[model samples]
Target: MSRLYGDPIEVWTREGRPVQFVWRDRLHAVRRVVDHWVVSREWWKTSDSDPGERRFWRVEADPGSRIGTYELRFDTAGEGWLLMRAWD
Candidate 1:
């Protein structure tokens, strides 16, 4: 599970998989994908506002000497990429 903040970000993906991303003005390279999941349409949302099939990836990020795990999601509409949450 993740708490999404909807914070916009710049992501670089290769072969449809995220390799790195820039968040909070810092660049972090994703070392591994710990988990993966997909979210279907929100039940509460109206048909006009439905965002199709969101892809969520729980990934380990390495930023220089420190490392952290973050949750990222790719939206098919509206926002392209977002950093949902980060674990300390």
Candidate 2:
């Protein structure tokens, strides 16, 4: 297995379903689904509340699962991506 740090990873449902949620480097809860997605749009910005400024992958757990969504953000300034958020 590969380390889950600064590495490109893919997630899917327990039943082998296509994953469409986000992933971040934090403790997250599992909902109806579990997976990781990639997202990137803007990179050159100083604002913190900028929406879609940075690329991010959102892993949303299925509603029935009540797991949660995993979110990852690609930091152009940092030269890599990191886990940024998780839903519970």
lDDT of each: 0.84, 0.45
User: How many clashes show up per model?
Assistant: 0, 27
Query: Which candidate achieves the best lDDT against the true structure?
Result: 1
Tens-place lDDT digits, model 2, residues 1-88: 1133444433333443334433433333334333434445545644565444445555554434355455555554454445455444
Q: Can you tell me which runs of candidate 2 are displaced by over 4 Å? A: 1-53, 61-67
lDDT computed for candidate 1: 0.84
Name the weakest run of 10 consecutive residues (lDDT summed) in model 1: 43-52
What C-alpha lDDT, on a 0 to 100 scale, does residue 24 get in candidate 1?
Answer: 80
Best by TM-score: 1
